[model samples]
Target: MLIWERPEPSARASLSPLSRDRIVRAAIKLADADGLQAVSLRKVAAVLDAGPMRLYRYVDTKEELLDLMVDAVYGEIPAPPPEGDDWRAEVRSLVRGIRGAALRHEWFADLLGGRPHLGPAALGHLDATLTALRSAPGIGDDPDALMRALQAVNGYVLGAVRHEIVELRAERASGLTEHQWQAAAGPYLARAFAAGRYPALAHVVGNGSHQDPAEMFDAGLDVLLTGIAAGA
Candidate 1:
């Protein structure tokens, strides 16, 4: 429902034709380019060559626009098929799609964490996810159990996205590959291990740390799903 426009700076502000969708797209583009701090109705209106007050026809407050933006971004997420042969596979697919969206739009992962859940797109995401979990064997019978499962999965996805974003930012800033980070950390870790200043940390690092996030996610998912199956 959002419309995109590439405006020329020479266009007169008073002559601009603005719609709610256009305003939202401008805000989203601003956030994508300059981070959330750069987004404002006034700023978005200026980008659209319109006045700030014009945006109020659609969005009453900056908060409302942000809510719409979050929904719009979330709407980009692919909702998993209502029926899949395997529930776990379906859930995994849903998480992966969400993760992909977060990766594509770094601001999305950040926005979801910091914003309140108010939009239908946000609720649609939750509804679809819970619906998938409920479709799983055993979860269909208990609403409370289904709620717990959804919460656990949602938390894991949020944490994973945040971790991924931080790693991406670090990689961009340091220009260090995963291998390079490990290689550089190895020497300092070895010295710490030799000194025995932190035996547990030394033992973990010296034994060859398993910091591969995919492995971590798989292990955590396995535990959560296993626990859900057992308890539910």
Candidate 2:
């Protein structure tokens, strides 16, 4: 049974009043403030003003707590429209919501895909994605095709968001804007380009306009959706 499904034991009424939701929220708060490494049963209990052993009544282990935390954040993502929403647009919205969540909880990207998320909130998000895919105008009832398209979009979002979070963390750590960092590295890149080992990269890097991260993400999503349409 999922952690949320298990009933809280009645014997723990004498201890600090705690539920799985409270513990999960406390953990998320700790993670958001200090990253995933800062989160632990002891730390969360302290945050709740309870003993470490009191938390075991709600969650058995730290890993289970992490799972709950991930799902709780997933619950924050907006659900797709019930009617008249284009599949491609829904996919875009879904991914953007995930990106926003990752930005809000910097530690979220680390735990994503770390384990199966059977929690109700995570399963609801998955169901919403599948519902949109199935409702696509051209996508018939081929489960295999639907699964492939879902996987492709999911794979792209995970990779893109992971890179974004890494760069964001680096920027935070270095206290340098992306443009400043690029400018600092410009001379080294110029030297490498002058060596002429990669003409195509040199040409693009030298001449191409810098695209904002959102634009890049949208462009990739457009390409992915186009490919899915063609295949459909």
Candidate 3:
């Protein structure tokens, strides 16, 4: 059975005082500091001053622990402020919330949308998003449209966040800012552009200014919301 389906153990007097909550929190801390690769049952147990075998009482397998960690990150996402009937505003806020959470816990982008998140925190975030989208006046009483709308927004967010995280990871690993990285390969790019085979790429590369990431994400989201509004 999934961890969420299992009843939480009641608090009992004990010297260890260890619980699933503590285990998950410790794992999250490790992940936040050193990425998901740093997390393991043995390491989590070490952090909690317990043996790895003891962890099995709370989590049946490594996958369950990962699920708990993912859910913990979801719990960090704040609810959208009261934006009554303004589906766009509400959704925009929730989208930003998810992005913010991903940025804070880079490992989150690695796990999210990769599997079904059945934990309470994950379910709560999904429920909140659906509620916000359901407020769309034009989408009223149409279950199919509402489901599509939710999936579309979630799909975009998942893809975009993964892309952002990948770029971030690359930048960190290479020890170079994007502009610096581009300049390092300027000679190669110049030769390629001069070939006249990729006119559109060259034109855009020459004409486009460096855009702020946040602004770019917001602009893309706006385009999506506009299309949704028109269709609904």
TM-score of 3: 0.92
Q: What shift in Å separates residue 54 of candidate 1 from its native position after superposition?
A: 0.8
Candidate 3's C-alpha runs over 4 A off are 11-15
If scored against the real structure, what TM-score would every candidate get?
0.80, 0.92, 0.92
Give lDDT tens digits, candidate 2, residues 1-232: 7677888765455556787888889999999999888999999999888999988877899989988898999999988664576788887788888888998998988877644588888888887788778766567698988989888888888899999999998999999999999999989889999998689989999788779999999999899988988878
Q: Which ten residues in a row have the lowest lDDT in candidate 1?
A: 2-11
For model 1, how does the per-residue alpha-carbon lDDT over 1-232 read when each residue is reduced to its tens digit? 3212222223234577766667778888898887788998889988987777777766677777777787788778887765555677678767877787777778888776543475667777777777778876678968888888988888888898889889888987899987899899988878878887899887776685575766676777777777766776
- Which pairs, if any, clash in model 1? none
lDDT (C-alpha, whole model) for all candidates? 0.75, 0.86, 0.86
What total of clashing residue pairs does each candidate reach? Answer: 0, 0, 0
Cα error, residue 41 of model 3, in Å, equals 1.7
